[model samples]
Target: MPLHLADLVARSELHLSVVAAPDRLDRPVEAAHASELLRPGQWLQGGELLMTIGLLLPMTEEACRAYVQDCAAAGAGALVLGLGRELPYQEAPAPLIAAAEAAGLPLLTVPDEVPFIAVTKAVFAAKAAEQHRALERVFDAQRRLTAAAASGRGLTATLEAWVDATGIAAAVTDLLGRPIAAAGLDDLDPFGPAGLPPAVTELVHKVAGRGLRGSASSASGSLGSVEVQPLGANRLRGLLVLVGTLAPNDRMPASGLVSLLSLELERRHLADEPERRRRSALLGRLLTEGVSAEHAHDVLAVAGLASDTVRTVAVDPSGTSAEMAAEVAADLALAVPGGLVRVHDGLVEAVVGDNLDLIEILSRFASGAPAGIGPAVPPEAATGSLRQARALVAVSRALGHPAQTREAHSARLLLEFGDRRALRGYADAVLGPLDSADPTGDLVRTLATWLDTGGSWDETSRRLAVHRHTARNRIDKAMRLTGRNLDDGDDRFDLWLATRIRQEMKAPGT
Candidate 1:
């Protein structure tokens, strides 16, 4: 269905004849150009017909062979040697013929009466005619596609009509990379349990992460060449993917399809705004103020995040607007079913079920943003999860990456999630009188050091760089104020643990 060297040679008006590589005359010709330089191949692109008048031509047998090799190497579809009155050669040279035949490069001879301009005109005319016909077909296909879209039959019918018109398989995916609609041209169905091809799926997320700045890109994979086009007007709504073989002209219909499909997705997104707002409100309520376990479960169930246990994932909205962070959360929402995402206070957070793999979800959608995943907790205890997430989020930001609560490996885990009132009461009851009386931390340090050294006065004094008498005096004064005895195992252990807890919580997370 493409113009080939054989077609040009077979034309009666041009008076052209194949001089070499007769069997290889079927090479496709994409364009035509003329040059008289020795190595004319320098100007040629692949599938071009190069015409020369033998000026400054290589005349030797070896030189001719190299010339033909150069032409073939440059991906010239055919070589046309003009034989006319003013040209160096009156006919095809034997060396040139031998070289062309050896290299399997189709060589054509133009009759003296036929000028090189006629050959160039013929080549481009055929190309223009082909393009014109393609445009005509595209116009017809656009009308059919528009009708299908206007029929209100949804994306499938519009895609089906486009496929029937252009013979290209296409699919649409949400920002989460979930397949929304797919239309295959023939027996190849893009929609299956296996889902979209890995390359297409990757591009979907890549474009989704870029939001409004995203553009179109293509990749080759198991499905051959696939092109991904981002869909939306003011914001990203989804991705439109075209898979399989595509002609240059095929972009015409694909663009039209993108416009039609983007409108539909935008409409759907607008329609879902109220529900999204409600879910966001519920998440805010669940995070800031405590929600009843039953009401939390109801909210989670209504939001589609149904799990007896769930973890809270929070991303600090640093160097980005709340709107931008919220968009990122919305993009991540489709990474899993029942993934509830919202912007509460200043952080972009999500309540995801523990049953799903959080790591993989984050890997696929989180990109470069720092995320902190809190420990799995019940719906009623989500407030604590948010607390832990806030604590770890700073660590993640400082580390310039994401982290999980399980990765903390410190006392902050228990200290953050435990009852704040009870822990505060315990610390105050244990350290209150001593801290008030001493004002400085010497007494607490002496008691902790003495306990750490197994009640060794000398070791405590040595560690503190003080005399044994001074350490003994401090310990006695601490005992007098706190009413605790170091010789008792219970008192010693409680004192040590309380001091460590206080030290760990001294610097809090923002």
Candidate 2:
């Protein structure tokens, strides 16, 4: 229990007496401080018991009232006015007492014979004891949680320990809020037929969607106050939902519990990593190379992906790695329902039952990098889809955003399967003159725009935000570089094809 203003007055040895707003004596006193400054509120935090000698107090009644109001506004637990020697009167001034009463500020009087040191000592002693007890609780909770985890009880055991320590119904859930472990709230099925109850569902969204690490609650009956806490660092691994409102003192333990649960969950993922790799390898082979429908069906079954029609998504690698690709694919599979992801040919590939928003999911984990997607296709046609997705990857990089195969307009299919070395050599041969003079890519942008607009200078200028004369000048320079006549349809078509091939290979126009 916190010390209150009445507790100090009740101490007969202290020689303190209440003079104003005695009814509000129950307010908790966080600490007792002595100040002689006119406006001590500048240094005073709330919930403090402010003790002062009358030497620095204003002589005017109105000034005294303002002084009292300042302390109250600063959230002082109560004001203790010394009433002898330096005091103008034997007791608190009439205006000061009246102001305190109006503001519901508790005011106490200390006789000059009693020193302020006694009050300060008592407050410090109580605060120290409270802190010691809080530390004890935290240590005890940590030991129990560690013991339960070591007992091979898994996440469920740790959650049970949290319930025992905090006396609240607690649960661990996946990103989608499906309960993986629970205690004290058997009736609250986070994955029930109707899914998590409305109250719990709303709180889960707030925590996961907003990336809130602190507790969030819903004020609903039966469900009561539900607190949702996130459970990972860097990226959210899962959620921790407590059914009842936690005590103010239990907040620290709740955070520690989240840390412990995150470690245990990560350990579990590590233990299963071997099997995940095997699954990723199989899926990778199936997507990059042509596989018979029957053979693909068998591989998908073994990988736990039972989808007949799956959408292929391609993520351009940040760096090359088969292991990194496998890890990312496995993580995506766990995050999404009924999905298989793998790394094939230095790219991350995901196949999902539905065309789930891989962009949104990747944003949660790996943002800033664009992804390419192929339209949904039959399982046997995965290689064809991967080919299309590969093409979209180039398109995506060229457009500086995510792209889908269905939206592709260039000769992407031929570009994706062609020999890379041969294509780069051809591009350099065709656009070398332009690259020599225009290394800033201004000419390349102009050429791309002119080709896209079907040689319309007006539309090209509008698209590029340039004047008509500027667009024509750029086109003239590009034509001179390539030594092609813009008026000749054959020359224009050849340059357009070369530009398309260059974009697909991610090579500069040169």
Candidate 3:
């Protein structure tokens, strides 16, 4: 605790009497200075006790009032006067007492027997003790945090250690404001953007958008206090979020931890280079030979993308700065632990698990350039999604924003205003037999693609990743079931219209 006016007045030896503005005695006195100048405030800094013997001797009420107000304005914690018969005033003068009271400055009187040095020594000693304690706390926190970083237990361990050392909840988020590692977040989901508070997430984006030029930001919220600290030496690598207000003396410790966490992130990045390269290579192979190969499945398992449902994303690398593009690529690749991300040809692409909130990630990284998100499909059918993603990237550019596969088929959104039940009935009438015969959807998909390509077998087969013979067989099967003649323009038109309607009207995930 700091040395307050109350602390000195309570001591029996100093015999200091609080004669006015007693309520203000809680002000801390960091130092004590004795001056006889008519205006001593010019010589004093804040948090100092201004002691005087009334030597310049302003005996009038107005003169006394100006002196007292000056001291208060200069941040004098309190006014102390030495009382003695030999001095100008034996006791604290009545004019001075009234001035101090009106100014809301604590006024203390020193008896003739007490020396001014006693009070000055007391203030300096207490201030020294407080400073010593503050330094000790900072050193202790730094020691524990450093040890945790050295443990090589990863980012999570260091974060947990930080909370333990300082008792403040924290998390380290990637460039997208998604928590990569967290500690003491008992009330919130420890990972993903969905779990974090919207305000905090917005702040993360705001600071990250500024790069290294931005500084830390703090906000008051339901969680008491929240702070966002950007982490990086050359470019902004990540953010450190303190979920609660720090202790008054915690700034140094928090800064040290931010530096330590940055080192850990850089180290992890270097160490994971080979693994990232391997995932990138695997993604390339999947895009080429398709994901049906037994070896593809084995590699997918190792890459932590062992999911049946995955999405392909196309980000235009030309729109963003190299540094930002690199960060977003790294983030999207690790989005689902071993996600496959690679920069190929003229674009940056990634194979992400569909379970994550990919739209949010894409929105943050889009900048002015658009990204295309493919639909979720089985691993064996990943090539179809990649093709769709690349196609939509062109559509996204035209639309002036990031887009998804559904947006490319703009009919779905526009047709919703119509009588959906009525439209479904018409679609069912035209394609009901094909839907029933091909419950697996392969025939319906082939028929739609065949009609979409003006009855071209090779194009349909390539889009569906099937043999041209197989594609012709499925189209023929669909023609027989639907009673439609491809040779007739009217029949082809109705069949194509119905397939588009039926496919669009189907609820998502059906």
Candidate 4:
């Protein structure tokens, strides 16, 4: 409609002749621009009606053929050549016309009496009229959409009406990868095969990164597809995919309706963010309170989790920067499927279903992030295991090292053993120097025995079959090695705790 070659020729009232093909009328003319140089193809933009005179190049068969090929590659809708006294105008240039015909470049010869200005003016006038009509249609659609929106009609309904009016299919989905509503194809389910295609799903997944609107095939075996535009902030909301099969492409739906739909969708999502946050909070509480698996499933149903069975993983950061901890958690969440939420004090809890790989999940969590990981547990066991993971975090802090336990029970054991300051001291006293100096064998046996005997030196000496003085000296040496004062009453408690830790560490296959 925007000034096609036929329209230009009709308006100019010039004796036009097509020296080129009679069969190239199928191509749509998008716009009109003029170029007079021989190598105009270098500066050529596609979908234009290029105007020129054969003045810049030699009138030879090879030159004409090369020029036509360049016009084809540059996507010129049609070529208009002006005949004048400078170039021989006795008859149509057979070689140039033949080359143009072969290359599918529609060639229109301009009369010597018709000024190029008249041709340019006619094309501009036609284009302006077409643009004005398009704008009127767009304005009417916008008004109807605004009215529907003001009447408290939901986004999906408004979108449906818009699509119906524009004759294109439209759909809306949420960030969780579920379609909320759709129009045009009543038989197809936009969330799955009956509606949108896998390629559309992939595009929607990437919509968060950029604004997207392009054509794609339908999963319903339709010959043509639609242009999907991601809506909402950060393009996190679903998308508005316009499906149609018009010849030159439907401008009303693709451009006008799509723009309005994106704006409305973005507004809806912005208004819904607070409610979404509230729902997230409620779901988090449900996950933390040891809900039954069925209850968890129901909660997930409300939250729109796309899986039935799920695994729970807990992450804890000890002695690391909080920023680093958050980045690790965020990266891990993005790398996995299902939903991930950060709950209460640097704890990142995720619910993954059986569909995902356990080892790869764990490896990705640990990669490029230094943090303690708790073992994976089933979804229903998440609450208890999460608590255990917290306990293990405490143990890691107390021991000044990274620690991991696969289950709640094991984590609890490690946490209890690590909590005793005296056991830590005793382990340091006996094993510390030996482990550091020789890096082999255990020397914490006497300390473990002493603590087991309730810190009674006489009983400990008898157990070891040594003099009480020797046992006292050994205790003193151990205390000194561990950098704790044994003579203090407070140090006795510390020694008792440290001795317990040594016993646990020395346990078989610990």
Report the number of the highest-lDDT candidate: 3
Q: Give model 3's TM-score versus the native structure.
A: 0.66
**Residue lDDT tens for model 2, 357-382:** 76667665444455788888888788
Better of 2 and 3 by lDDT: 3
| Candidate 3 Cα outliers beyond 4 Å, as residue runs | 9-24, 35-46, 56-75, 94-105, 111-129, 184-194, 215-218, 233-236, 288-303, 306-309, 316-328, 336-338, 355-359, 366-372, 375-377, 391-510
Work out how many backbone clashes candidate 2 has: 0
RMSD of every candidate to native, in Å, equals 9.6, 10.2, 11.0, 11.6
Candidate 3, 1-510: lDDT as tens digits: 677888888888899998899999888888999988888788888999988988886778999999998898899999889998787777888999999999999989998888899888888888899899889988998898899999989888888888987888888888877788899887654334475678888878888877767655666466667888888776566888888778778889888888999898888776877877888888877777544657657767877666777888888867567666666677666555657887776677888877877776676555666678899987767788888888878777767677788786645543544577777787789888987887898987898888889888889989999999999988888889988898998888788878888777675852
Give per-model TM-scores. 0.63, 0.62, 0.66, 0.49
Q: Which is better, 1 or 4, measured by TM-score?
A: 1
Candidate 3: the clashing residue pairs are none
lDDT of each: 0.80, 0.77, 0.80, 0.61
Better of 2 and 3 by TM-score: 3
Candidate 2, lDDT over the whole model? 0.77
Misplaced by over 4 Å in model 1 are 31-76, 81-96, 137-151, 158-168, 185-191, 197-203, 212-221, 251-260, 277-305, 310-336, 339-352, 356-510
Candidate 4 colliding pairs = 311-352, 422-494, 422-497, 422-498, 423-497, 423-498, 423-499, 424-498
lDDT digits (tens) for residues 372-467 of candidate 4 = 444555556666655655665555555444445642243335445545565456457645664564343223556666766877889988898878
Candidate ranking under lDDT, highest first, comes to: 3, 1, 2, 4
Q: In model 1, what lDDT does residue 129 have?
A: 85
